[model samples]
Target: MMKAKQRIIILLLAGLLVLTAASCSSQKAADPATETLKLGVLSLEDILPMVVANEKGYFAEEGLTVELIPFQSTVESQSAIQSGDIDGMMNDMVVAALLKESGTDLKVTSVTLEATDERRRFAIVVSPDSDIKTVADLKGRELGISFNSIIEYTTDEMLVAAGVSPEEVNKTAIPKIPVRLEMLINNNIEAANLPDPLITFAEFNGCKTIIDDRGRSIS
Candidate 1:
């Protein structure tokens, strides 16, 4: 059996050990890794939840300091990521797939949105005065489209479904939807392909939707 003083010394040593353990835990809690994390967002609408997360301090509660950077295009946002100017981005799957195919350092960490209707985000149209009433009527008529994306695939599908071969239409490449819209408005092209909200805008300006992929599958 130990003497009473020895017993007290053992108790004190045990207390010291407990205090040391508590100190270590406190240091860990205060470490820089516990600090807020930086993140990037493509646009306000691209991921509204991210905007809400930042505005409502949800990320702050999670120890994150997400910096939302709005870019004109997904390509611009992806470029920012590649250059390390931003940590990550909420962008289109095509951009992500391209990056992965090329073995880019960036990986799509999460998918915020999956495209369902091709026309949910895009639409095919003709001018009100134009005789082109159906997709079949698009033969020899100008059709505008962006290159090498879901747009191309969906447009090709639209053409095929309308009994029009892809070769039948005068395919024009106007990469920007706004430019395509301008062409449509100016009658430079009998038909123009554009994405939303340009689709909505074009329709508002009297462009007719001859074919829509709203309920159609692009996959």
Candidate 2:
């Protein structure tokens, strides 16, 4: 098995082939500007390889131009791709399925982050004053999540993996990460599903982590 960093580098280079494939479409002139690949991305660890490649002139050396467009959310990222404002964007399997279901032609070029014992990507957390001390305690309470998103999937996965059946769970569509975090911290929502940084912050703020996807890669 390749190390995590090595796998990321290889996958990122592999992803550039998508740009090359698109470069052949409807172009009459050799315009360097038009040939530039536009990739819509969120500010995540996955963007690191693209940043390094751009900064070190790797794309230019390889006769390719790349533009990395930052997006605030997946909704915006998908909107950019669908409107042709961007050629591609970093996305997950859940979003890919949703895109296909919506009739969008999508291709998954690479896997940026993989599951590892040291990496805790997401968690189901409860409010500081919440009576929910475990995933089983979440049966009748609301779990905040962004609707039809990875967060929602993570919540469901966390529940099922922890032996809580779908009929025993309750989900509330909070739709925004910041809002979800705030609601969970302030006791507005009994529990909320979130990724790291926010998950660590919630722990620091006295919110309890009922479970997290660390070893079990359910998401």
Candidate 3:
């Protein structure tokens, strides 16, 4: 009798297992196929992880189809996402905030990178031969930057941190980074905010860094 009862219990448990499997199968059948996310990014070292994940098939393994769209500049990438040319982008938080303020319906899902001593991402640089050695010296000087963007925001913060008011510094709108770097090199601009690779390149070409947002959380 006890053996018969045990068998009955085992059968009931198996029935429950079958029901759960059927429910899951029906749910999966009702759901749509995995989605493909079109994400935009600039050609920067900070985006290396995304590149690696795509190369390694990690996104595929997770049931996500990712398409990485590369743009020459952050503004271009942001515009792509805003215009629905792409679904999302890797950009500065300040830019994202400005986008939201300007009525772009978007959300910041994650922070991919942070400022650190080992990974200096942004800096204010000047010609090595220039007399502007400190942030305070940047006062009343023309700093080349893409106005109303993250570069300007960071420059303002860095300058204020060094006891110089943003209003005291003259900002020149130079949207193209290469142009800004060239202007800095040729003394066409007293100073300019630059991101990695460019900052390193400028340094190699006799540019002096005034301040860097290292060990600080910009986003």
Candidate 4:
């Protein structure tokens, strides 16, 4: 019940974000009366607001029907969007830009999550058995991240802040979040950047966080 309430509050904030972004990008939001929107999303915790809102009839109150579609990976979700299977997506800025670059008509609708001074959504963690103890130790090391995505972007930003040059930053692309988490837990990957719940789960499983998006503007 507490979690549900928390998600409801987040839903309010997300509602504001969507309205503000929609107004900036266009004249106004689509008429909610008798409108239906099919939205695609990965199975990430950030979907809580959407879930809560839908369950609570927030959209219905606005006369909109939102259908949430689940995709296992970002690539799958992007493909679905390209093929017109879904009208919109809950994705990071990096992916939104990628979609625009690939000629898909896209817009920054809203931010599901962002790093704040008190909290961050992403982190770089090392296996319990791995020798990489510090951020500096990650230079030229195998760091798993989804290439050209927000995962890699966050990793790079944090690495450079720790004095690791772009050339020295070695990153391995493991796009699937579950795969990255599994590999890191199994010691198949020395380190990987993961979002909140997964990052906390990995830490519970003995992974050590060396750096995160905390205090940084990037998310």
lDDT of each: 0.61, 0.74, 0.72, 0.78
* Colliding residue pairs in candidate 2: none
TM-score per model over all chains: 0.64, 0.76, 0.73, 0.82
Q: Which candidate is the best by TM-score?
A: 4
Of 2 and 4, the candidate ahead on lDDT is 4
Which of the two candidates, 3 or 4, achieves a greater lDDT against the reference?
4
Give lDDT tens digits, candidate 1, residues 1-219: 235444433432332111011122334454334543335443223355555556766556556565666665445655666665665565555666676677655544444332365426556888666778888888888888765655677788878887789988888887554567778877778887666566777788888888766766653
Error of model 2, residue 175, in angstroms:
2.9
Indicate the worst ten consecutive residues by lDDT in candidate 2: 15-24
Query: Mind giving the per-residue lDDT tens digits that candidate 4 earns over 71-117?
Result: 75677777777877777777777877777787777666556767789
RMSD of 4: 4.1
lDDT, candidate 3, at 194:
93
The pairs that clash in candidate 4 are: none
| Selected candidate, larger lDDT, 1 vs 4 | 4
Q: What is the Å distance of residue 65 in model 3 from its true position? A: 3.9
Enumerate clash totals for all models, in the order shown: 0, 0, 0, 0
Name the best candidate (by lDDT). 4
